[model samples]
Target: MSADQLLDALDPDQREVARALTGPVCVLAGAGTGKTRAITHRIAYGVRTGAYTPTAVLAVTFTARAAGEMRTRLRELDVVGVQARTFHAAALRQLSYFWPKVIGGAPSRILEHKAPVVAEAAARLGLGVDRLSVRDLSSEIEWAKVSLVAPGDYAVAAAAIDRPPPAGYDRTTVARLMEQYEQAKEGRNVIDFEDVLLYLGRILQERRDIAETVRSQYRHFVVDEYQDVSPLQQWLLDQWLGGRTELCVVGDPNQTIYSFTGATPHHLLTFSTTHPGATVVRLVRDYRSTPQVVDLANRMLSRTPAQRRREGGIELIAQRPAGPPVGFTAYGDDEAEAAGIAGRIRRLVAAGTPAREIAVLYRTNAQSAAFEQSLAEAGIGYLVRGGDRFFARREVRDAILLLRGAARARAEEPMVEAVRSVLSSSGWSPDPPSARGAVRERWEALQALVALADDLAAARGGTTLVDLVTELDERAAAQHAPTVDGVTLASLHAAKGLEWDAVFLAGLSEGLMPISLAETDAAVAEERRLLYVGVTRAREHLELSFARARNPGGRAGRKRTRFLDGIWPEEGSGRRRPGAVRGSVLTGEHDPALFEALREWRSRVAAETDKPAWTVLVDATLEAIAELKPASVSELSRVQGIGPAKIDRYGATVLAIVAAHR
Candidate 1:
């Protein structure tokens, strides 16, 4: 494609980004705003117009997958020789080249897992070496290293930020463990992932000749997801630039959700102040989601605290047509929530929406168990994002071996039947196990293979076991095991940079959404941003739900997340609330006349007591009273949100109103 053709594909905002190929360009890209397209076209246009040499440009992103995608896009544009790499990848390449000259041989083997080393360090310090402690210690050490805090300064730094120590240790002990961890790595002659950047930054600072050579080789830079840049990454980027600024950064402040991993959006937000003459462009036209989805996302973020809100943030304007109004639901318990979502998914699949285009996202990994069990029981194929790979499971491996042996023996039955027969010997059953543990997990994995076999046979008529074996081998080799026909189950953080046709945000209760650990205002703001991320992941259908209790027959004490205060409609208005089911009395099935009468009575009682009407009885309680038509104060006292104190104050009036309605 020609340079003009590249410009032709971009919108006006993207065109501005593509044309501003000079130094210090900032693109304030909103979610689903085509930031990748803008940045790639900018690079391609620069190369096609003879303004940049392909070899001199370096494009950096956060992940290898994203970097590979950029390279593929540039190659498709008929441009090549540009280096697209993660920060660590680029740093490690330079470190490998300069290591022998600067210090020693082969730069130390990279440490793949920090848990064992952390455990050892904790043991030496006489601290507990349990799995969770080791994991938390590893995380804290990484945070300190990336935030540029040294072992001696860790305790003070941690206290300043109010960072609690791991369960078994104090801040001082954590600092000691940090020292021991470094000593352990040195003793092993190895380095962790963060050390790659740390050592490379030191080398570039000390060795000006090497730095100049690197600077000469890569004169221009483009950074994607710049909002996630940590202080250490920014320091390394400064070293790479060596005071020369030929850089363009693309990021969305609202999607800055990795603060726990030492990431911050301060650098992205302060780019203009740092680069006085920079050209700043905002890309807010969202081509990914429908207008309804975009509207919900916008409203969610509008409640962000002014101090934490992005200074120049742009609201997304949906480019797609209107979609269904987002759904809000409440269930009796976790089981009900999961089963309800699964049933809805089955209906959608039967309605022709591909199962692969649906997702169930929650706040934590532990929350996936209920959904997994429900989906498996419903016979819906689902792949848990960031969970164990299907091919890596032992049952799956054993099943594949069984299938391969059966295929070599020339099984004569049909593909699905033969596969099922083979798997039945390995403990595969038509019905899922009643228990929920390793037994259930193994069953689910084998059942996935059965589903795969059925899919293959349907896609290719009259296939044999041999063809199934070949498909399994190919998929295992590619590490892509049967996710094409499965619904996605992911955490909100894992679902970043991904979208689906339908999204169900489950477990939106107070403690889960804001998370019990979110103590500070800033932390709560980030949690809200996380829900915003979840909301925007839908293209057409969106449903947000919560369960009142953790288990059936448990106390229903949970409330909806406070973040949805005014956004979620009031009860009895033909709309859904936190604990109210649609088409139920709490929604609009109750007599409107009685509900209105109850509201008026509550208002009068509130005026007499000089308290708010909600203090007397909220709309949801009134709707419940109207629906139940309680004949006595005892019946009125049984309704939800009506405690003994409330009954003493207004139970008589409420019962009287219910009697009048009856």
Candidate 2:
């Protein structure tokens, strides 16, 4: 394709980017804006116009997947020989090429994961070394390295940013651990992933001959996701540039969500100041989501604290037509929230929405258990992203093996009872662990298996232990166990760069969304941006919900996320009020006397049953019952939250109350 043909396929801003083929250019691209298209076309246009030699052009991004995408696009445009790779990939390549000539025979073997080394270092330092602690320490080490902080300077640098030490360790201890970790790596003769970048930067800085060779080969550079560049990455980019200004970078400061991994937007925000007379283009036309989603995304960022908000953030403009109104809901507890989301998903799937285009995103991986259970119970297939698969979990695997063995031994107990007995022998407990983390996660996975057994028996009468095992095997096989065909369950951080037709942002409470560990102002702001990323992932349908408590009978002390203060229904007029019961619409009117009577009866029954009042019937459902005045079991079943189970349990009593009111 000719240069003119490439420019013809781009929008106005993208065309402007393509035309600026000879200078330092920065594109502040918003979410869903075709920034990839813009930058790739710019490279193609430059190559077609003979402004850049295809072999000398290098495009850098943050992820290998992203780099592969760029290569694919460039290949389709018939522009070949451009080096498209991640920062680490590029550094590793350069390090391998120059290592033999500079200081050694061969480079050290690369460490695949820092956890084992981190654990060893922690043990040597006499620190507690649980799985979570080791993981946290590994993250802290990566953050310190990427921020260009040395072991000796870690304490002061960490304190300057109010960065808390991981796993309850003090700053001094963490600094010492960092030093010990380096020594351990050196002793093992292995370089970590971060060391790949560090070593390459040092070689480029110390060896002028090597630096010139690299600089001469890659004359033009294009960087994607520039806002997520760490200080070390920027240092490497500078070395690659060798003081030349032939560069084009693209990023959106508002979408910067990886700060916990040492990413910062300062580089992208200050690019123009560093390189004067740079051609800056703002890509605000969002071609992915509808106008409603775009507007919510804009407002979500606008309401961020002034100190935490991005300066000169780009506001997204919708390029698509209107979509469904964004949904907000509150549930009595986590189980209800999960079940409600599963129900809505079932309806959407029945109404012609593909299951693969739906997602239930949360703030943490530990939150996946409830949704996984609910989806399975509802017969909806799902795939967990950035975490272990439901059936792939160790606890689930162990329980299934135990059940299969028990079935072979001809256990005489009922299906659910026999399954519970096998699981109990393998450490399954009736109550959840008091704390959260790996232990709690294990329990939840086991509980899900038990629930699966109960559901199978209830759905199919006289289900034997053998039958339950067969059902498990079939589900494990057909749930798209490790594929992308089912509904996605992912953490917000993991959902970046991915979009869907329908998105349910679950667990939108204060502590979980902002996360209790996000103590600093900047950290909280990053959390807000994380939610913005989740909101913009939807093309049409979006729902945000939170449960009042963690467990069904637990205290309802949690509140909605403060980030939605002015945007939520209670805070804003002329908007749909958030439903107290999932999938229920409120008329905001009810018979006062009947509503009170129903609440009283709910309290009495909850006290007798040792459950929460909402478990009997939430206020919204009671209000719905009062207003609608359902007088029969059939009529009562028509109310929201009144499914077959509830109807069988409370239908007659509810109808009797309505009769008395009448």
Candidate 3:
């Protein structure tokens, strides 16, 4: 389907970027600017125009999900024979094909043992064996390698950043740990993630024939999220483009929030310098957001702290008022905050926002409890994002394991562990006091359920793997409802590749959002990008909320976000007051005592004005009134959220002193 066929029309910039197929084009596109569209369409147009064979073209993204999504879109566009994969995936494929020839042997087996190698290294570094998780340590090692930081260089970089090591180890230990990890990975006959790039880099640099073969195979290379290209990724790109190869990289520098992850915008911004004759393109039209949302995002970008000299900062904001201003409510505690958000979600759903269209975002996964409880109480459905979503939950994972195990007895050991988790989580109290002989014996029988699955499937004449998979899916189908309604609770990382009707960015406090540690230059820039990514994901309404404290008395210890300052920039930006956050909220923290006070005030105002409660006021306006103690309508509107529609509606009566305080 063309751009015009989609529900959302593509802007001129988007159309041009999407259709452009000539030369070394560098698109400095920001989030919500139809970047994904630009690339997919570019591929489609290339195929249609006969510039290159789809099979000869290569598309690379940062993640597996991104690669799959791009491939899906290409297939939809009828662009066939193209290969799309993560950088690692592509390198691995190339290496796999050539590993046997170069070394006169099969591929190294060390790669498969990355976990055990990391574990051993961590132990030597004095890390707490139980405390240091294999998965987390591997992730750190992978990130370091991709950033081009070797074990020898790890200490210097760690010192430069002054970042603490994973709980059990300090700098010296981590540096030593990484070194040991490198040696172990080598010994295991498997090259870890870093080795993939190193091997590929070597191929391109040491051997001209290999480099030329790859270059010939891939006529064009398209990179997504180009600003996040790490040093090693760039080196790989350099080899691929040896001499001159058509390259197109699209990214938003302001959205470059992964410097800590070893990603940098230096290459993205300096593309023309290094490539020479590179055509730099900047996209300004944001096809994703409505005008109001756009105005807020652009303003936020302009006011960001000292930013690096990078291309693709926010230029055009989408202008649409598909929804109301973002609602902000301060809660006395985490429980109250969750409850308030959950309650609002129920109301939002009842008012027509589909649960899926709404998303509840917070700083950490730990904060979802209150909201989950509230959602449960209201019968509103929601899904937590990331592996931590349900699997990370003790109660939920236990339940899921039961379903997976019982459904697929022939399944691997993960199935048995699932059942075991249920008993343990349900408090079997393994001690003799809690374990009856019958219960213990039943548990033992359950342990052998995997054998039962295989026997059952075999007896039923199920021969293929698909048969067992089908039964498993069937069992899960009979489980709880899969799709959630009302809102999705997710972390920012999990929110990628998703768009929605409304997005709630909760907990925009200083310590949480930019974080206190983000006081440095690079860290602050990343924080800005993180906020930008959150803002651009919204298809319509975007709510940015914050609280002074988790508890009113918890801390002198609390602060509103600096990002909020950008939203309601008090001083004019060469014009009248810039657009402020769009919703209403309650000012005081959640309290039953204040609820009555708030309700009584609502009743008196509703009676005199004869307007619906919402018309007379909304959550944000009331919160503003409470915070500013506005004596009149003029002052109220002047307070951040009250806009013209509000001023014209109930301007007079709202100005009256509420209780005629003497």
Top-scoring candidate (TM-score): 2
Q: lDDT of all predictions, in order shown?
A: 0.82, 0.83, 0.63
Question: Each model's TM-score, in the order given?
Answer: 0.74, 0.76, 0.70
State the lDDT at 359 in candidate 3: 87
| Candidate 3, 591-653: lDDT as tens digits | 333333433576567557643343344433443454445566656666554577866765554
Stretch of 10 with least lDDT, candidate 3 = 432-441
Candidate achieving the largest lDDT:
2
Q: Count clashing pairs, candidate 3.
A: 20
- The candidates, ranked best first by lDDT, are 2, 1, 3
Q: Point out where model 1 deviates above 4 Å.
A: 303-310, 389-484, 573-662
- Model 2 residue pairs with clashes: none
> How many clashing pairs per prediction, in order?
0, 0, 20
lDDT of 1 by residue, 5-115 (tens): 999999999999999989899999998888989999999999989989999999999999999999999888888999999999999998999999998777899999998
